[model samples]
Target: MNSVFTEDTKTGDIIIQFPAASKLFKEYKIDFCCGGNRPIGEVIKSQQLEDKDLIKVLNIMYEQMQTTEEIDWMTMPLTDLVNHIIHHYHAKTRDLLEELSAFVSKVYRVHGERDSHLKEVYTQFFLLKDELEQHLLGEEQRIFPKVMEYDLNNSLETLEEARAEINILEKEHEGAGDILKKIRQATNDYELPMDACNTYRLTYLKLEELESLTFDHIHLENNVLFRRL
Candidate 1:
């Protein structure tokens, strides 16, 4: 089937153009966040992924995803992008982390005796929360304002500085992604045991939500905002 995107299309560009593509890429374990600069074909080949006409499959999925709710982040102004990131991702992440920390702590304390995995889950999550807190603080206080200023002035020096700072942020993104993968493994993809209580179930559910949010957050930063920088 003829598709709007080809195997030669960059992974990030494919995601930017098709909202359904991100879910497909994530389901295939394709790194559409930090490693999104390469072509989809190249990424698949490098990862040794074998798929039967994945591009056709994606095109079919996109046709069904007819909702107009998705934002045109690619063509959006840099300042608007920054504002959206802060409001949508940063603010929500802070609130989620706050609520999730209480849930994770309660689960780890109450159920860690029964399930050894909770210990690892607890460790990895707090580590992630800490890193994300610092990362958000850095972005809000220093990086984001610089980005808006750069956007406003079109100054080469500001652009260069933003680029340098975003390189650091990309490293942070990789670290967070790594921690997220570790959490997923520790929980075996948020599987719940038969003896699980309400808190335990809730903890796993929230973790899954956080995982999805973090993936979307990182993709927006690494693939969308950072590219524009």
Candidate 2:
């Protein structure tokens, strides 16, 4: 297989080929699980990321993987995994959501009339923000604690409790994902109008970030956590 990473390659395809891309995608907050069909350039531009920086990181990751072992999600301690998700993914996403919400609100206040989609996008963003806030709470309060208990005691009872919480979390994940799809459809995949200003572009970029974060959140809970339970 050719090891050269190409900018023209689809982000999801690259992830499928290079397992290391999964880690990079997680670092960049890029979606490779659900929303992995788009090209790397399109995903990067939509998120307003510096394409050169992303490519540089990808190349380095690819080179490093030649000698490095893939990360084993299952074998990692549950406490460490929970802490990692909370400190890295949840905390960063909460900050991003707050910033994006304010950005959308400003755009709506300033340009809602000129661009009607601003109001629509703003509403969708608020819905997603609220849902994610609650979702994170559930994980922190209910799911993560149970996982940690299981790790400490190695008890089937703790594992059972974790499984119960995970079921609810999975449903919430699906609901959030549905809302993201609606937002993408409403904005024509974050396509901006001809008269869009900087804030409009920022809103789309934030949506891309949210999309990526949500996928990572769900992937951790669904693929990694659930398997542990």
Name the top TM-score candidate.
1
TM-score of 1: 0.91
Question: TM-score of every model?
Answer: 0.91, 0.73
- With a 3 Å backbone cut-off (N, CA, C), the pairs that clash in candidate 1 are none
RMSD of each: 1.9, 7.0
**Model 1 lDDT tens row, 1-229:** 4577777888878788886687778777777777777888887777777565677787787777765887788889999999888998888888889999999999989888988998999999999999999999998887888899998999989888888788788899999999999999998877889888898888888887788788888889888888878
Off by over 4 Å in 2: 1-69
Task: Please give the distance, in angstroms, between residue 226's alpha carbon in candidate 2 and its true position after superposition.
Answer: 0.9
**Candidate 2 lDDT, tens digit per residue, 37-67?**
5778778888889645787677777776763
> In model 1, what is the error at residue 98, expressed in angstroms?
0.6
| Shift in Å, residue 161, candidate 2 | 0.9
